[model samples]
Every structure is written in C-alpha cells, then in structure tokens.
Target chain A: MNPMIAAFLVLAGLTCASALAMAWTKNLLHAALAMFLCMLGLAGLYVMAYADVMAVAHLLIYVGGVLILILFGIMLTQNSRADQYETHNDLWTKQSGRFWALSISLSVFLGILFILNRSMSSFGMVSNEIQRSTKLTHVGLALLTEYSFAFELAGVFLLIALVGATYIAKHHE
Target chain B: MNDIPLSYFLIVSALLFSIGLSIMLLKRNMIFVLMGIELMLNAANLNLIAFSRQDDQIQGLVFSVFVLVIGVCEMSVALAIILQIYRHFKNIDLGAEKSRF
Candidate 1:
C-alpha cells in the first residue's frame, strides 16, 4: 500500500526472479547477467533494510569485483574446439539430472519454511533494541575501535588469498 | 521501509537460498556451481542485514563484512584452482573423471 512496502516488494521480486532465472538458464552468459541483476536487487533490498552502508559495500564488491572474477573464470576454463557447434562452449553448460535436484532442494526449502514458521513466535523472545540511523560514522568508528583487529586480519587474509591465487594460477607444473 | 515486517525478508532469503542450492545441485560447470554458492552467500548476507536493522551492536553487519571478505577470498582461490584443473584435464566440468575422484 505504502511506497516503503511497495519498494520492498518490488526489490524482493526483482531479486527472487533474477535468482530463479539464474538457476533456470543453461546459458552461462545469461546466468551471469541474471546474477548481476540479482546482486543489484540485493543491494536495493539492503537499502530497504536500512543498511545503506552494507548496500554500497555489497554493490561495490559483488558487481564490481566478484562478477569480473567470475567472467574471467568462465573465459579461462572454456574448452576450445574447432567444431561448428563448439562456439557455444563458453556460453553454455551442462546440467545434472534435473528431477532429483529439484526434488531435493524443494524438500530442503519446505523444511526451512517449517522451521521458520515455528520460530516466528520466538523473535519476540529477544529484546528488540533501538534501531540505528543510516549513517557511516558509527560503522567507521566501530571498525576502527572495536573491530580493528578483525578488520586488519581480514585485510591480511585478502592479501594472502590474492597472492596465493596468482601463484596457484601460474603456468607451472 | 519501516512498515516492512522481518518475516518477509526472511522468506525472500529462504527462497533465494533454495534456488541457489538447486542451481548448485543441477549445474555441471564448476563456474556455475560457484555462482550458485555466491547466490547462497548473498542470501545469508541479506538475512544478517535484515536482522541487524533491529540490533543495537551492529554485530550482524560487521560479521557480514567479514563474510564478504571471506567470499572474495574463496572466489579467487577457487577460480585459481579451477584454472589449474582446466590445464591438467582440459575440462572444468564437475566430476568429469568420476572414477578418479
């Protein structure tokens, strides 16, 4: 009814639809595009959840960083062949048996739903705390003060991971 | 935005998580499976952000940041491993040589 709820609904639709599309499509490129849209919608959802800072960070990381890396993976691992139909090699991927995949995942989803429905009464068990404003100052202060050690460790881990990735990907035996 | 209930977000996240799981189960390409993993991770992140809206300590947000960092590391390392696998076998399909694994 209201704009806020409307926005939430729209973003949620976008995210879920794109995610479904990504799963449904066999074309790898189409899936990548769908993933892009999915990430964009997720950022909007974060905004709806009042985590604007998290939204921005997510947009930057997923869209700008992870996507490009995925594209690189798709490009690098493609099996090149001289056949006529081989051009689809990079764009398309094979699927495992569909029926079991669907049935298993659907059952798991139903189980999760059942659990969530049972737990709805328990959210009230926790003390509902005051909501914070959508400002970066508090986050910045906390990252620097309370979370400084973890932040530094994350940076170091990122560096090590990148370096290790490069070393592992090199043209060596 | 303020009027939105937490259950709605939870439902959406659950839906996404399920879809990603199916994708992971169904896809043969290693890259496609990786994409599914990313989708599931994003769904978990959304849940954290949604619940953290009502949290005072902002722990969920911080934890999600670390999650993001870890995701990036995983993607990089996995891709590198994939590249190596491609060089060795000329194919990146999961379980291509099932008897070996």
Candidate 2:
C-alpha cells in the first residue's frame, strides 16, 4: 500500500462521507457544515492529482467566496414562520422521499461505473506520458499565452455576474 | 513519481456525483439544492484534473480553472435568485408546501 494511495483513500472517504452527510441531513446549517468538509476534501484530492494551483484556487473560491455566499443566502432567506426555538432559527428542511432519491442515485452511479470500466482502455493514451512535473508552470504559461482570450473572458464574465447578482438581490419595492 | 491508479479517482468522482444528485433530488430547501449542484460541478472538475494528470499540455487543468470560475458565477447568481424567491413566497422550499418550481 503506497502512502499516496493511502492518503488518496482517506481524502476520498472524507469527501464522500461528508457529501452523504449533506444529503442525509435536513437541517440547513448541518448541510452547510457538511459542504465545508466536502470542499476541503476535494481540495485535498486535487493536490493528490498534482493540481496544486487548482487545489489552492478551489479552496479559496469555494471555502472563502461561495461558502460565504451560501451562508448569507441561508440567513437572508429563513422565513421564520416555523419558529421552533429562538436560537435555532428553524433551519430544518424537508425532503420528498428517500426511496426514489437513493435508488436513482445508486443506479446512476453504477451505470457510470460500468461505462468507465468499458472505456478504461481508451484512457490509457496518457499512460506513457506520466509527467510528474508541477503543473503550475505549464498552467500559468498556457493561461497567459494560448488561453489569454478565454482568461480575460472569464474575468469579464465574473464581473458581469457579480454586478447582475447585486442588482437582482436588491430591494425592488 | 507516485503512480496512483486513475480508476480510484474515477470511482471517487462517481460517488461524489451520485451523492450530489441525491441531495439535489431529495432536499427541498433552495440553498441545499444549490449546494448539491455545486457538489456535482466539483465532481466533474475532479475528473478533468484527474485525466490531466499524465498529460504534458495540462489542457484539463486549464479547463477546470475556467469551470471553477463559471461555478462561482453560477453560485452567486443562483443565490441572488434564491434570495428573491424567498422574498416572493416567504419561504425557500421548492416542494415543501403548495409552491411548485
């Protein structure tokens, strides 16, 4: 058992477990906490894949930016109609049912696994070029040179989205 | 030069995507649904990064970066829309009550 595989197993376990916890819990806050753990585990998995840049960026964006946005959405939207307790804020949510959701997800996962198994040999095209160099250098240069247009487009799109979000969220009375 | 089999990553990615799909299907809260969508997006990005591991060009890595940016954009916009929906119906549950969406 190589240490790398061991670490990957641990991180994948953490990611999947927290994701399941998020799916199982009805409380909004608990789900948010579970999402936090899931994202952290995902960042770990990215690092294991030698995507240090993507891992750090993912950690920053999901943990710092998106999570805060989600928390704000939680706070701003609680109706307070079912005020079970003062401190709790009535964060419990509802689900349609367990049977369909569970069955559908299981089926989808198994189907994907079967397909991946069938197509396994096709992915071997990259087997011979297993470069272990840090991807940060290549990613940076490519984003600036070959992908400069797309890179700028992403920035502009982000600006537009933020502006549009603020406008949409404003009090429109 | 650690050589972790790619199948492990794919399996993990599949599991994450399935759990996220279940969450999206099961949860009624708009925020919970959004989180589920985020999870699915991350799972796809994981596949991209994993596939790019052995490639020298790192095309998947760059694509994943753009995906991350787009995911953030979607999150912000969706959260804002959810906020407005909350104001309209005074609740965020998609199917919890008489509301349908």
Candidate 3:
C-alpha cells in the first residue's frame, strides 16, 4: 500500500505491457515504439532500484544512441517499391509461426517462476538491507580506481565498434 | 519505511526475459531480432542491479556497467551486418527461401 511499491508496480506494468505489445505487433515501427516505452520503463525501474546513475546512462545510451541507430537501419533498409513518393515506409515485418514461439516462451516463463519460488526460501538468509544512498560517487570511484582497466578497455571496444560499423556500412563497389 | 522486496525485481526481470525470448523467436526482421536481444540484455542488467542493492561489494553494479557497454557494441555491429545482408539479398527476412545462407 506504500508509494514505493505502487510506483514499482506501475513501472513494471508499463514495461511488461509494452514488451508484450512489441511481441504481438507485426509492424516494425510499432515494435520500435513499444521498445522505446519499454526502455523508458526500465530506466524508471532502475531509478526505483536506487541506481540513478545507471538509469540516466541507460536513458542516454538506449533511447538517445541505440534507438536512433535502429531508426536509421529501418530507413536505409526499407522495402522501396515503384511508389517512390510513398510517405510511409514498409514497416510491416513477417513473423514466424506463433504456436512454437508462444508455447516455448510460456514454458520457459513457468519454469523460471517455479525455480524462483523454490529458491525464495534460501534468499531469506541474505541481508535485507537496501542501500538507499546515491551510487554515483561510489560507481565513479570504482570505475576509475578498481575498474579502470576495464573502463579503458570498454572505451577502446566502443571505438572499435563504431569504426567497424561505419566501415561495414560503407558502399563497396 | 519498508522497501520493495528483491523478489519483485526478480519476477519482473524474468518476465522481461521471457518476452524477449518470444520476440526473438517470433520476429523475422533482423532489426526486430536485435531489439529482442537488447531486451534480454537489459533484463539481465536489471537482475544485476537488483542483486547489487543487497551486496556489500557492489560487484553486480560494476559488472552491469560492462554489460551495458558490450550490449551497445553488439547492437552496432549487428545492425551493420544486417545492413550488409539487406544490401546483398535486397531483404532482411531470415529463413527466406530466395536467399541462400
């Protein structure tokens, strides 16, 4: 009945519903929209979990960078027909048979729920203290001091990925 | 003054993971599949964040940051490859009989 649980439930609902929408829709653009909402809800959930830094980073990277890239991919790869002046791109995507997908995912979901239910008793022994403090300072210090090597490595990896993507996407005659 | 239980976060992550799996299995477009992969990655990241809340070392938080970086890298590379595939076959649909993979 508290506000925190209420917010969590609302955010989780938004996330799961949009994810289902993404799964149910055949239109690629609609799926993208659903993904956008899903990412938003996830960021909110991160904030609720007390990782505000991660929430912001997730917003910037996924919503700002990745979603734009996805849109560009959709634009460049559109199924252009003779109607060159058509405003709407062919956003509809073909789907595989639903029977197998639904059944498999359903079973997987049920299995995970069963496992979690069984494991819940063991988790009771774990510390219940929730760190409500801001993690920005700690995360920054850790990234620079303890995790410096990995941080630099990630920077290099990102640079390589960017360069490689552009190279592969370039027109080769 | 009570906080949300860890189990709630775990349940949400599980749901998200399964939805992502179904999306990966159901969608035919390369980009759609990529989106599904992103969802799955985020679900794992959520689990890490939730666990980090309870851990003294905060290892899960640090690890999740790396996971985020790796995910972005994967997305960029995959989209590039998808673009190349589209160029080669004039379509990005997987398992299409017209294109020999």
Candidate 4:
C-alpha cells in the first residue's frame, strides 16, 4: 500500500479505537481524555484531506476551547468528595440486551454503504487537484458575500442562546 | 484499492455516525450523551469536507465551518444547563426516578 493510504488507515484506526474506548469506559474523566485523542485524530484526517484550515480550526475549537469547557463542566458538576471512588454510576445493563444497540448501528451502516455503492457510479472520478494554497481569504469573502445573512443570523442566535443559558443556569432563590 | 477512494471516507464516516448514535442511546450520563452528539456532528462534517474535495465552489467546506461553530455553541449551552441540573438534583444522569415529572 502507498504511504498516504497507510497513514490514512493509521489515523482511522486511532479515531475509531479512541471512540470505542470512550464508549467502553465507565469513568467520565477517562472518556473525556479518549475523546481528546479522537478529536486529534480527526484533525489529522482533515489535514490529510487537504483541509489544513479546517484541521487547524478544529484543533483550536475542540482541543483548545471545547475540551477546556468540558473539563470545567466536569469539575463544577462533580460532587466534592475526595474519597469517593465511585463517582460514576453503575450504568451497565444486562449483556444479552446490549447487543441490540450494536446490531442496529451495524445495520444502519450497511444501509448507508449500499446507498453509497449505488450512487458511486454516477459521480465522475475527478483527480485530487491541489486547490488554492490559502483558504482564509476565500472563506472571509464567502462569509461576507454569499453567506453574510446566515453568518449574522448565527451570531444573533448565539447571543440569544448565551443569554438564555446564563439565565437558566443562575440560582433562582 | 487505489488511492483513498471516496467510498473509504464514506464508510469511515458511516461507522463513526453509527457509533455516535449508539453511544447516544446507550450511555446514561448526560455529558457522555453530549460527547456522542459531538461525534455525530464531526462525522457529518467529515462527509462534507470529503465531498467538497470534488466541488470547485467549496460550499461543503464552508457549510462545515458553520456546523463547527454551531456545535461549539451547543456544547457551551448544554454544559451550562447540565451544571444547573446537577446543582438542583445532585446528579447528571438521565432518567433518574427522583427527577421524573
């Protein structure tokens, strides 16, 4: 196999393994750390796909910002007990019924694969021509010109949601 | 078979999406559920970036950027809400009998 394909497989494996670890672990902190690894792998995959801008943005947003947010959330919400080892609830159900979730997800994946296989014939196979060197200017222009309204709407929505969330979260004594 | 085919990306994305869904359904912790949601969002974003590789307009890439922003916003607000819930109920697990309406 080519080096690029090999790299892709390695990244894919890391992402999937971390995700499964996140699912399997009962410890919340361990799951969060696994998610961090998973996100890092995803950013590497984005870089491989020639979306360096997105990879950088994703790393910044998820690793730098959101992960910190999640950590703080965990800290603030957790019970203040230095001695309690069982912070996480025992949430495992019976083993026999657990397979249903995996089976359902597998069937959904197979369905998607079937659809993609049918549609693959129609899409022309285009070579991966290297695109522009930088996306910052193009993204800025598109945000201002073609997507200005939606951009503004997102800002407004975020503002409203922030205000609402703050209001709801405050102690109402 | 050859270079990384579009199908490879699609299948990986599909698996990610399914895993995310199963996590959402199976996990009892609210924070874990939120992580699942984030995973699902990223899976969709990956699909968009992969497809936008073929299009000259790069619309899918642009859309994915917006999706990223929205996901962050969602995460912040949801975590804040979870904190409040924990303060009131002393727990963050879903379907607790004490918190039932």
Candidate 5:
C-alpha cells in the first residue's frame, strides 16, 4: 500500500476509535478527552485532503475555542452536593435497550456503504491536477463575490446567536 | 504514493456518522448528545472535502467552511441553552422522570 493510503487508514482508525471510546465511556470527562482525540484525527484527515487552511482553522476553533467552552460547560453544570466536598455528576444512566441503537446505526452505515459502492464507478476519472496553492485567496474572493449575501447573513446570524446565548445563559431573576 | 480513493473517505465518513447517531441515541447527557451532533456534522464535512478534491471549483470546500461556522454557532447556542436548563432543573440529563407528569 502507498504511504498516502496508509496515512489515511491510520487517521481514519484514530477517528473511529476515539468516537467509539466517546460512546463507550460513561464518564463525561473521558468522553470529552476522546472527542479531543477525534478532533485531532479530523484535522489530520483535513491535511490529507489538502485542506491545510481548514485543518488549521479547525484545530484553532475546535481545540482552542470549543474544547475550552465545553470544559467550562462541564465545570459549571456538574452536579455538586452541599454536604460533600467532592463534585462529580452521575453522568451515565441505564438505557432500556442497547441492541436497537446499535443495529439501527449499523444498518445506516451499511446503507451508505452500498450507495457509495454504486456511485464510485460513475465518478469521472481524471489525473489528480496540481491543487491550487492559493486556497485562502480564492476562498476569500468567492465568499465575498459569489456568496456575498450568504457571508453577510452568516455574520448577522452569528451576532444574533451570541446575543441570544448570553441572554439565555445569564442568571434570571 | 497513490492518491486516496473517494470510496475510502466515504466509508470512513459513513462509519463516523453512524457512530455519532448511536452516541446521540444512547447517551443520557445533553452535552454528550451535542458532541454526537458535532461528530455527525464533521462526517458530512468530510464528505464535502472529499468530493471537492475532484472538482475544480472547490465549492465543497467553501461550503464546508460555512458548515464549520454554523457548527460552532450551534455548539455555543446549544451549550448556553443546556446551561440554562441546568440552572432551572439542577440537572442536565435528558429524559429525567422528574419533569414528566
């Protein structure tokens, strides 16, 4: 096998394994850690796909920003008992049935696999062209020119969301 | 090294999506469910990037960037809502029996 394929396999393994760990673990903290690993693997995958800008942005946004936010959320929301100094929420609960969930997900995966297998042969074959090195420039131009309205709308939406989130999270009288 | 096939990416994405779905269903914690939603979104993003590799326009890559922004916005808003829920109920677990009549 070629090195690219090998690297892809490794990254894919890391992503899948960490995701499974996130599902398997009962401790909320462990799941968060597993999500960190999963996000790391996703960044690596982005690099493999030649989306260096995305990889870097993803790392910054997810690792630097969202993970910290999640940690803060965990800290703030954890169930604490007044009588005991220790603080840990009972994060796990017994579900009535695990088999149904697993089976449903497995079938969905298999269905997607089948569709992908059928569509793979139809993709036009072409030599891999040299990827444009000017990704950031091109993306910026496209966002401003072709998708200008969407870009402005996203900014507005983000501003609104931030305001609303802060209002909702504030201590209510 | 040979180029990675589209199928490889698709398969991986499918697996990730399925895992995310199962996690969303099985986990009791609201935060865990949110994380699962993130995973599912990322899986879709992976598919977009994979397809964009074959296209000259790079539309998928651009779309995925927007998707990323939306995902972050969703996360922040959802977590804030969860915090409010915790403040009100003193717990963040979903489907708890106390609220239901």
Candidate 6:
C-alpha cells in the first residue's frame, strides 16, 4: 500500500472514531474532548488533501476559537449545587430516544451511498493533472483579486457577528 | 500524490454527516446540538476541498473558505442564543417541561 493512502486511512480512522466517540458519550465534557480529537484528525485529513492552509486555519479556528467558546458556554450554563466546590463540574447531559436517531442517520447514510453509486460514472475527472504546488500563494492571490469583494464581505460579516454575539450575550436587566 | 479517489472522500463525508445528524437528533442539550451542526458543516467543507482538487480554478476551495467564515458566525450567534435561553429557562435541555415552572 502507498504511504499516502496509509496516512489517509489512519487520519480518517482517527476522525471517524473520535466522531463516534463524541456521539456515543453521554457526558458533555467527554463529548467536548472527543470533539477536540475529531477536529485534530480532520486537520490532518485536510493536510493529506493538500489543503495546508485549511488545515492550519481549521486547527486555529476550531481548536483555539470554537472549542474555547464551547467550553465557556458549558461553564456559564451549568447549575451549581450547595455541596459542590470549584474542583468539579457536573457534565452529564440528557439524551433523547436512541432508536429514532440511529434509524434516521442510518437511512441517510444508506441513501447517500446509493446516490454516490448511481452517479459515480457521471463524475468524470475535470483534469488528470494534480497541482502539488502549495496553494497558499494562489489562494491569497485569488482572494485578493477575483474574490476581493466577497473576501471583504466575509470580514465585515465576521465583525458584525462577533459584535452581535457579544450584545446578545450581555446581561439585559 | 493524488492516488486517493474522490469517492473515498465522499464516503467519509457522508459518514460524518450521518453521525452529525444522529448527534443533533439524539442529544437533548443545546450545546451538543450545536456541536452536531458544526460537524455537519465540516463534512460539507471536506467535500468542497476534495472536489476542488479536480478544478483548475480551485473555486471549491474559495467557497469552502467562505463556508468556514459563515460557520463561525453561526456558531457564535447560536451559542449566544443558547446562553439566553439557559438564563430564561434555567436549563438548556431541548424538551424541558413547562410544568416545572
């Protein structure tokens, strides 16, 4: 087996296993830990896909930014008992009926598989040549040139979202 | 370097999306549901990156970047809303009882 395929398999396994762990756990903190591992594995998969920029950005945004936000959300929302000290956090979370969730997801997966199989032949390769060159420069240039307007819009949108989020989270009393 | 088929990526993403769907459906906690939404978004992003490999213009990559931005925006706003809901109800469970109040 080629090393590249081997690496891809390993990364995909890590990603999927951690994702499953996240789904299986009832503890919220355990789920958060699983999500961290899942995100790390996904970043590795992005690297294997030659998306180094995306890998780094994903690590930074999901790991650094989003995960922290989630952790904070968990902390701020919890109720404290009289006997509890700061050493521990109540992390157990409730879950609904597993039957419906499992059946729906399984059916969705099967449907997607059927569609992919039927349409496999229609997706002809656009180019046989693979560009192994680093996409950083190309992505930057394109974002500045062809996609400049959208790029600026995303930036402005991000600012608005952050400000709005802060406003929404404030004490309204 | 491109030995991997696009189908493999699609299959992985499909699996991810399914797991995410299940998470969203199964978890009663609001934060857990948000995590599921993030997983679904990431699965879609993975598909975009994989398909971008075949395109000379790499349009899919650029689109995925915007998707990432929008996803972050969604996360922040959703979490904030969840925070307010928790304050109002004193619980974040999706199916909390109104009789308790």
DockQ of 2: 0.87
Candidate 5: deviation at residue A74, Å? 1.2
Interface RMSD of 1: 1.2
Best by lDDT: 3
lDDT of 2 by residue, A65-135 (tens): 99999999998987666554677544788888889999999999999999999999997765756667677
* Model 1 Cα lDDT, one tens digit per residue, A38-147: 99999999988888999999999999999999988888877776774654434778888999999988998898899999999988766385374774777888899999
lDDT tens string, model 3, A1-173?
A: 89999999999999999999999999989888999999999999999999999999999999999999999999898988898898874478999999999899999999999999999998878866778999899999999999999999999999999999999988888
Stretches of model 4 off by over 4 angstroms after superposition = A80-97, A125-132, B1-3
Task: List, residue by residue over A44-113, the lDDT tens digit for candidate 6.
Answer: 9888777889999999999999999999999898866677775764488989999999999999999999
Interface C-alpha RMSD per candidate, 1 decimal: 1.2, 0.9, 0.9, 2.9, 1.8, 1.0
Over A19-39, each residue of candidate 5 has an lDDT whose tens digit, in order, gives 999988888888889999999
Candidate 6 chain B lDDT trough over 10 residues, lowest sum: B92-101
What are the RMSD figures for all models against the true structure?
2.0, 1.5, 1.1, 3.2, 2.2, 1.7
Candidate 6 has which clashing residue pairs, if any?
none
| Higher-ranked by DockQ: 3 or 5 | 3
Chain B structural similarity as TM-score, candidate 2: 0.94
* Residue B48 Cα positional deviation in candidate 3, in Å, after optimal superposition: 0.3
Docking class of 4: medium
Model 6: per-residue Cα lDDT over B1-101, one tens digit each? 44687888899999999999999999999899999999999999999998887777878899999999999999999999989988888888888793142
lDDT of 1 by residue, B1-101 (tens): 34588889999999999999999999999899999999999989998888888888888889899999999999999999999888988888877774132
Docking class of 6: medium
Tens digits of per-residue lDDT, candidate 4, B1-101, equal: 34466777887888889888778777777888899999999999999888776666778889998899899889989998898888888877777665551
What lDDT score belongs to each candidate, Candidate 1 first?
Answer: 0.89, 0.91, 0.92, 0.82, 0.85, 0.91
TM-score of each: 0.94, 0.96, 0.97, 0.88, 0.93, 0.96
DockQ, candidate no. 1: 0.80
Q: What is the alpha-carbon lDDT of model 3 when measured against the actual structure?
A: 0.92
Best-performing candidate as measured by DockQ: 2
TM-score for predicted model 2 compared with the true structure: 0.96
